[model samples]
Target: MTLLAFLGVALLVVLAGSRVAFYGDALAEKRGWGRTWVGLILVAATTSLPELITGSSAAFQGLVDIAVGDVLGSTLFNLFILSLLDAVSGRVPLLGRLHPGHALALGFSLLFLALQGAALWWGGPLLGPVSWYAPAAFFLYLLAARLTFLYEKRRSLGQEERLARLYEHLEAAQVVRGYLLWGGLVVAGASFLPSLAERLAEETGLGAGFVGTAFVGAVTSLPEVVVTLSAARLGAFDLAAGNLLGSNTLLC
Candidate 1:
């Protein structure tokens, strides 16, 4: 029954998360923010909210193992999903269509991971609530975002008037409606994760890290899988790739 409940809740998350792609795509078109920006930050962040919630809640409850495991496991699992997306992409190669800005994101992500690893290896000092890695990661994330913004700006030159018109015609009301409706559902579904993961860990006699990496990790990431596959099905390759890559990068 517990396992079934886990599956049921995971399904809800997927359903709620899948709709994010549709609304995100529409917002990108209406705002002319382009797929890179929407997929990397907006849609990715929204879909990844479950992890944010799960991690924070687990930490608050003193389940540091689960919190750390979920982040690491989800990052790897998200990358694995990219391979699955490639398989189902039909004639077009999914990775071939991605923007070059993703390289910067990947680089920054690796650098952050390396910092965490170094801290772990050498036992780096803490900064109150977290280790030194925390603030460092934030700074690197900011730099990554800035670099991406500049890259997009350079690539989209001379389209200011068109972008202005796109902005003028933006469907603010409907977009907010969609985000609120789906976003609420996502939050509701995600809220169940911490307790469920704890129960599952206890029932299975697995370490929190192992269970978090295997079960909770996959469960929370179902949203990304659903959204990415849905985007791929519709030939929204950039959005699809960006969502996965961005989610993976942010997982650190």
Candidate 2:
């Protein structure tokens, strides 16, 4: 029964995510936001939502290694996803338009790993006193954005912006209906899903933490791969490269 409920909730998360992606692609079309930027800034984050949940829970539960390992390992996989995007794009030369800014993302990602390493080492066995590592990740996000601006300015590349899908499915009535209503549904759903995942570990001896950290983690990360490959296949190398690498930098 527990596993059954979890499966149902998992189905909902996937369904909600698919709706979000469809509306998101349409939203991008209406606004003239190029596919790459929309995938990076909006789509990537939404798909990574499961990671944020599991990673945060692991961190909050003092499973620092699990939290750190998941991000680190997932990032390596993200790189694999990028390499796959480049390979499948068949955009010739393979190194074609491999944006210098993406190199910057790799550098930032290295720095993030360094910080996480230092925090865990210096903070002792618990890795909690250095919980500031989480917030510090945001500062790194700011730095990435700043570097992006500089990169584009140097190369004369224009700043890109995408349309908000909120304008569509979301309405004034929905907004006025209050956070307690829709927000509650989202939160309830959120709370329901992860706990269901947790329950799987409890009942099945499969270790929810590991399943959530890995199996589910890989599942959630797929949308980025799909969008990215689609963009790359279209010969949008820089945009595809930028979305994956840039998102890795921000999320890490």
Candidate 3:
């Protein structure tokens, strides 16, 4: 029953996430937002909702191991999804199509991961109840976003008018309504994750880190996988890769 419940909830998360990707893509096009920026800022944020909620809740309860493990595990899992993309993306390498600017995301993810790992080993806080590592990670994330924005802007400079006209047919009210509707479903499904992880840990006599890495990590990442594959199928390769890498950066 526990495993069944996990699968059921995961499916819901995926469905909600696919809708999010669809509307998010349309909204971005409507607003003249770059695919990379939209994937990083908008779509990535929505898909990462589950991990953010679960990780925050775990941290609030002082389950630091679970929080850290889930974040790191999710990052690794998201990167692994790239391999899956490679398998499905024939002929041209998926990476070959991506803008070189994505190196910002990759670099930042590694930096944040290093910071977190070092914090665990160094064992002290630089601020009240918060480690020195936290602020560094946060700042790096901001820097990465800004850099990606500039790069995307430069790359898409000539296409501004074209991009703006692309989605003029979409009604704002309908798009917003769809975003909210699907987002609500995502929250509903994701809200069950932390408790599910706790229960799985208790039932299996597993450590928080192990359960977080192996089970919770995989389950929570369903949304990203679903969205990425769907995006690829639609030939939105940049959005697909950006969403995955962006989510990994946020997860860290």
- Best model number under TM-score: 3
Q: On residues 120-238, what C-alpha lDDT tens digit does candidate 1 reach at each position?
A: 78877877867887787778777777776667665554444544454465477787688668867776877786568658767887635654456666667767888888777766666
User: Of the candidates numbered 2 and 3, which has the greater TM-score value?
Assistant: 3
Worst window of 10 by summed lDDT in candidate 1: 157-166
Show pairs that collide, candidate 1. none
Models 1 onward score TM values of: 0.81, 0.62, 0.83
Model 2 Cα lDDT, one tens digit per residue, 7-98:
67655554444444444444444444434444545555655555577678898999977776767766777788876865675646656666
The alpha-carbon lDDT assigned to residue 236 of candidate 3 equals: 66
Each model's lDDT? 0.73, 0.58, 0.77
Clashes of each: 0, 0, 0
TM-score comparison, 1 vs 3, better candidate = 3
What TM-score does prediction 3 earn?
A: 0.83
Q: Best-fitting candidate, measured by lDDT? A: 3
**Model 1 misplacement above 4 A:** 1-8, 155-170, 197-213
